[model samples]
Target: MKIRVLGSGHSGGTPMIGEGWGNADPKNPKNYRTRPSIVVENDKTRILVDTSPDLRVQLLAANIEHIDAVLYTHGHADHLNGIDDLRSVNRAMNEWIPAYTDAKTWSDIVNRFNYVLEPLKNDTNVFYKPCLKRNDITVGQQFEIGDFCIGVMDQDHGFMRTLGYRINQFAYSTDVVELPEESFKTLNGIDTWMVGALWEEPHITHAHVDKVINWAERVEPNRLILTHLSHRIDYETVSKRLPEFAELAYDGMILEL
Candidate 1:
């Protein structure tokens, strides 16, 4: 299996429009982060996680031509705003994509982008709209997308909730501050963990660096990649401080696990 970090930055991304690269170097490509998103794929299928506001550029950068499924972590704007871009993929493939998310997230997504989930029109000539088959799942439920076994767990994201996905020994969780005791069981035995860490300081909605470090220590994953990072954390500086098992993720970083 291959897990690719399509975009590793937080909602606003690095080098914010109004506030340029705070502590990061603008010349560094790593500092040019986009919104958070990833692609998990194997020989048989390609599953996209989160659409991200920068989904089009990210996909173009990664040269991704096809996607079989989409798994949403939450309904936040940064994560779902690029949803309309999927219409081009639908048109190219000539097939409606299947998107999986928990009931609440699914409801929120459909409520906002109802056209994407709506049934396709009888006419085949019109191909400018997205037609996705929505699958509402429950947290902690196990499901299959092609040949992979997926385990879902609920995450604590302050005002809103999110879902974490685990596939085999690789787990991806972001936009999270706390992982409930019950959810720990779902993360057990994961060799690789891609989690969120905003900065060194505490954050209400996202995990702080210390909190993420503690989680990694407890989970004891062989490899840990931090995502959803903000400009407050410089790529090279943070990379130097991270433990051997953990490091910061950059856009287009591919891990063949």
Candidate 2:
């Protein structure tokens, strides 16, 4: 199996336009972080996780031409705003992409993007529709969507809880403020853990660097890669201070596990 880090930056992404982190150097590639997303694939299937606001550029950067499924972590705009981009893939493949989301998340996406989810008449007048199918995903359940054995884990995002997933030995969880005991135990013996750490200091709604470190120590994953980074935590500084099992993830970083 292979896991590709498509984007690593938080919702606003890095080098926020005119946010004045003092003119990031054009040549410094570290400053070029996109919104968070990833691709998990094997020989038989390609599953996309969290199509962010920068999904278009991220997919092009990764040179991804086909995706069989999309597993959503939540309905946040940064993660789901790129819904329209799947049109090309659907048209070319002549198939509907399977999109799996929990009950709340699925409804939220459909409500927010009514035109995409609801059946509509196309120019052909033969019931032209978006070539994507949204399926309700259940938490704490193991289900087979295609070729992958997916284990759904629960995570808290402060206001509400969201579902994170495990495919093979790699578990991807992000924007997680609190992890319940059950989910924490499920992370045991994971080979690669891709998790979220928003910044250096404490956050009420997101995991800070210290909290992430403490959690990692407890989980003891063989390797950990931090994602969903904010502008406050520069790549250089975080890389230097991270624990041996943990490191910062950058766009286009591929981990073949």
**lDDT at position 116, candidate 2:** 57
Candidate 1 differs from the real structure by a C-alpha RMSD in angstroms, to one decimal, of 1.0
lDDT per residue for candidate 1 within 113-190, as digits (tens), equals 999977667765566787789898888899999998999999999998899999878999999988998678999999
Model 1 misplacement above 4 A: none
lDDT, residue 39, model 2: 96
lDDT of each: 0.90, 0.82
Error of 1 at 92 (Å): 1.7
Per-prediction tally of clashes = 0, 0
Which structure among the candidates has the greatest TM-score?
A: 1
Question: What is the total number of backbone clashes in candidate 1?
Answer: 0
